[model samples]
Structures are given as structure tokens and as C-alpha cells.
Target: MTTVSILPISDANGERIYRAIAPDKQSTGRTAGEALDALTAQLEGDEFNALLLI
Candidate 1:
């Protein structure tokens, strides 16, 4: 099983940002939900593996 963590970070303009982190995978977005959606799509190919999104 692989787990991805969504970290809340700050952007250059001091706005809220979200980043997803996993093995060989990374994604950034304006919101946490958006980041999660992007990460999910990226991991779609691993159909048999378990993924934990945090």
C-alpha cells in the first residue's frame, strides 16, 4: 500500500496551497480538494495497489 499526504503550504502571494506527496509522485493545486483529485487521477493506473490519501 502506498500513502499520499496532502500538505498545506503557502504560495508566493501568501495564499493557501496544497501539495500531494508520494513515491515518484507530486502535485500542487490551489486547494486541497483539487490536489487530491489530481493525485487520484495520476494514480489511476495502479488499480491493484492500495492507496491512502491524507
Candidate 2:
């Protein structure tokens, strides 16, 4: 199974943000959902379908 980690973080400006980390891809967004969405878009094939969120 493919594993991904989603966590909240602060940007350089101290703005709340969300980050998604996968084996081959990473993405950040203003919200957790957005971060996951962005990461999902970057993934190829059915990888997203078997994603295991951590």
C-alpha cells in the first residue's frame, strides 16, 4: 500500500498551512483537504486509490 502523511505546519510568514508527503511527491496548501487534493493530482495511475493516510 502507498502511504502518505498529512500534517499542519506554519509557513515562513507563520500562516497556517497543510502539507502532504508521499514517497515521490509532496504538496502544501492552505487547508488539509487542499493539500491532499494537490498531492492526489500529482500522483499517477491508481496510486491515489490505494493511498493510506498517516
Candidate 3:
């Protein structure tokens, strides 16, 4: 199942998707956007993939 991990965004319906989090990790942020940015930068490769669910 595609569980959409909710997170903030400058444009939620834009390029970036959810703030990918580890299955056994805790996040440190005040807002979703902040968390998203953190995840975006901390993740493995670039932030471009099949993130949409149709």
C-alpha cells in the first residue's frame, strides 16, 4: 500500500513528494516543510522519481 507520509511543502502538488522517513527513525522538525527539506537533502540520490498515485 502507498502510505503517503504527510509533510509540508512550498508547493505540495508540485515536484517534491512526501518527506521520506526511515521505518525506525525519529524526525526532528517543527513543521512538515522543514522535515521534508531535511529528508530531501538527507536521502540517497536526487529527488526525482515516480511519486504520483493515479
Candidate 4:
């Protein structure tokens, strides 16, 4: 199964940033939801085995 980790962060402008971490892969978004969407899309188009948000 593929495992991913989510991390919340802020940019220089203080905008909400969401980061997704996976083996040899990473994705970012302006919001938590967006980040998850992006990360999932990158991982396997919503067919991921599992997702872990932190």
C-alpha cells in the first residue's frame, strides 16, 4: 500500500499551505483540502490504498 504524510505550513505571505510527502514525491497546495487533492491526484488519481494526514 502507498503511504503519504500531510504537513501544514505557511508561506511568506502567511497563506495556508499544505504539503504532501511520499517516497520520492512531494506536493503542495494553498489550502489543506487543495493539498490533499493535489497529492492524491499525483499519487494515484483517487485510487490510493491509504492516506495519512498530520
Whole-model Cα lDDT of every candidate shown, in order: 0.78, 0.86, 0.43, 0.76
Query: In model 1, which runs have C-alpha deviations exceeding 4 angstroms?
Result: 47-53
C-alpha lDDT of residue 46 in model 1: 63
Q: Candidate 2 on 1-54: residue-level lDDT in tens? A: 568888889999999999999988999999888998899899888787655564
Question: Per-residue lDDT of 1-54 in model 3, one digit per residue for the tens?
Answer: 122254533444455444435443323344565654565455456432314221
- TM-score-based ranking, best first? 2, 1, 4, 3
TM-score of candidate 3 against the unseen true structure: 0.39
Q: For candidate 4, write residues 1-46 as lDDT tens digits.
A: 6677888888789877889887767889877677767877777555
The deviation in Å at residue 9 for candidate 1 is: 0.3
Q: How well does candidate 2 score on lDDT at residue 14?
A: 94
Off by over 4 Å in 4: 45-47
lDDT of 2: 0.86
Pairs of colliding residues, candidate 2: none
Residue by residue across 1-54, what tens digits does model 1's lDDT show?
Answer: 667788999999999899987787878999887887787788866641645555
Total clashing pairs for each candidate = 0, 0, 1, 0
